[model samples]
Every structure is written in structure tokens, then in C-alpha cells.
Target: MHNNLHKTKENTSLTTDSEWAITHNNLTSVYRLMGDLSNALSHLQIALEIRKKVLQANHSIVDVSFNNVGIIYHSKGDHKTARINYQEALEIHRKSLSTVHPRSAETYNNIVFVYDLMSDYSNAVSYYQKTLKIQKKSSLSLIHPDLATTNRNMGCTYAALGDYLTILEFFEKGFNIRKTPLPSAHPDFAKTYKNIGSLFNKKK
Candidate 1:
């Protein structure tokens, strides 16, 4: 990977070129998968810097760069910084894409995830609501995996908020959605069953 990076750098006329940024972004993914978070962040920051210089503020690619950097920060346990970057991505999406774009929903989901990590259940629920609104209005099928995931996430957040009834509703929706495409033996079914079992225990 280091040799590849060297070769990429050598081939580029300027370090700030888009191709160089793409190479850094690719390296960031490799380092992240290897659990070398420091190097992952370093590469992503460089990629983001190059993207900022080469792209407009509301460019879709710049939004993607921000979201990727946010994911890295989230993996590193920096929820605040992750939220900041996620919000930046969301703002760009809002400015450059449709209100109900999938990218905006994804960004909302990212912010909700950080809020959940921070134990800010109310905020998580709020953002989750926004995510659902966009997803529902978008072109995604009713049984899309993303919708199921969001429903499951909402159930978990509602559980944290002590809204057992709402949790059951969301959980049931998610479970039903998963039932169509996934086999009975799928791990996702187990997870849904476990969540429902835990919900019942909490209710008792």
C-alpha cells in the first residue's frame, strides 16, 4: 500500500490533484479496514483537504468526502466531531440535492447514530424521524433494507426512551420487512427476536 501511495504520488503532477485525492481516499478505506485509525484519519484529512480545494462547497463529491471523514471520526469515538462533519455533509446535500434525496437521509442517519452513541435519545429520535421522512418519500421500496435498518434503529432508540409500545411497533415493522428477503435462519432474524425478547423483558 505504501508502494502504491508512492507510485500514485509520483504519477500526479500536483499533490492537490483530484486523482491524488482519490488515491488518499482509497488508502483511507484500506487503513480503516486494517484498524489503523490514525493513518486512516491522516489519509482522509488529506483527501478532504484536496477535495475542498478542487470542488465547490456544495458539490456532491465534497459532501461524500465530509461523510466519509465523519464515519472515520465516529469509528474513532469522537462523536462530537463526527456530528460536526455529518452536519456539514447534510448541509451540502440540502443545498445541492433534493430535499428527499437518499444522501440526505444517509447523513441524517449518521447524525442519529452519533446522537445515539452520546445517549441523546431524543435527538436521535428526531433525526431518525427526518431520515424516515425522506426515505419514505423517496424511490426506495417499502421493503428496502435501508428502511428496515432505520426501523430497527428507531426501535432501539425508543427502547432507550422507555417508549415500549413505540418500540414494539417499529420492531414489528422492521422484523416484517426483513422476513421477506431474509431466510428464517438469517442472523438478522435472530437479532430482531432478541430485540423483541428484550423489549418484553423491559416491559415486565
Candidate 2:
């Protein structure tokens, strides 16, 4: 992934356009997926700097940049940085988009996810409920990807709380929603199933 990014720098003449932006973004994502977080952040920082300069700061690309960086922090288990980045993205969405915009819901869900990972289940539920509120009001369907994410996060919270029944319930709800809207064998659903099995195994 870093190798690909170095290739991107090779095309200096192609610099600064949205096309270049996408290459850099892809490079950033690939590095993160490959677990090279430092490399990911370096390219992401460069891409984000370019994004801020090339596109309007409030453009959706800015949101994407913020989101990508936040996700890296989340994956790295840096809850404080994840929380701050999510709030930053949320602020950008709120300022640039409509009240019930999908992007705003996405940001809310993103923050909620980090809260769950941080073991702050109460705040996690608070934000998921907030996302649910906005999702219900939107013209979008109840089964939107972000909505499902919120539900899955709720399930994960229940799992963390050691309430297996509720965990199963929310996980099933989330899984059912995603089954049609997303791929059948999605990793999130796989996670829920794994959690269920792990809980039962421990009890035995």
C-alpha cells in the first residue's frame, strides 16, 4: 500500500485533482487494512492536506478524510483521539449538511462505535439512540447501513454488559437488517455470531 502511494507521488504532474485524491485515499485505506497505521496516517495526512486545499473545506471529501483518520484511531484503540476526530467530523457534517442528512447520521454512528470500543456503554447507547432518532426522521429507509451499524453497536454494547439475551436480540435485529441491505456473510454478522458462541462456551 505504501509502495502504491510512492507511485502516486511519481505522477507529480497529476497532482491535486480529485483523481489524485482518490489514489491517495485508496493508498491510505489499503495501508490501514494492512495494519500499517503509521503509514496510513502519513498518507492520510498528506491527502487530507491536499483535500483541504483542493476541495472546499466543508465538502464531503473533508468529511471522508476526517472519517478515515478517525477510523484509524479507532482501530488503534486510541479512544480519546477517536472521540475528538468523530466530534470534528460531526461538527463538519452539522455545519455543512441538513438536519437529517445521512452524513450526520454516519458521524453520530461513528462516535457511538468508538464509545462502545472504549467500554463507555452508556454513552454508546446514548449516541446510538441519537442516531436512531435522526434515522427515523430521515427519508431514508430504516435499514440504511448507518442504521444497521448503530444497531450492531447496540448489540455489541449488550454483549459487553454480559446480557447475552439482549445481545442476541440486538445482534439478530442488526443481522436481519443487514442481510438484505448488505451481503449475507458480512463480517459484522460473523462477529455477532462469534460473540454468541463465545459467551455460551464460557458459561459451559
Which candidate number would show the highest lDDT if scored against the true structure?
Answer: 1
Model 2 Cα lDDT, one tens digit per residue, 104-124: 778787898778767888888
Q: Pick the candidate with the highest TM-score.
A: 1
In candidate 2, what residue range of length 10 has the lowest lDDT sum?
Answer: 1-10
| Quality of model 1 by C-alpha lDDT | 0.92
- Where does candidate 1 have its weakest 10-residue lDDT segment? 5-14
The sequence of per-residue lDDT tens digits that candidate 1 reaches over residues 54-122 is 888798899998998899899999999999999999889889999999989989999998999999999
Q: Could you tell me how far off, in angstroms, the CA of residue 85 lies in candidate 2 after the best superposition?
A: 1.5
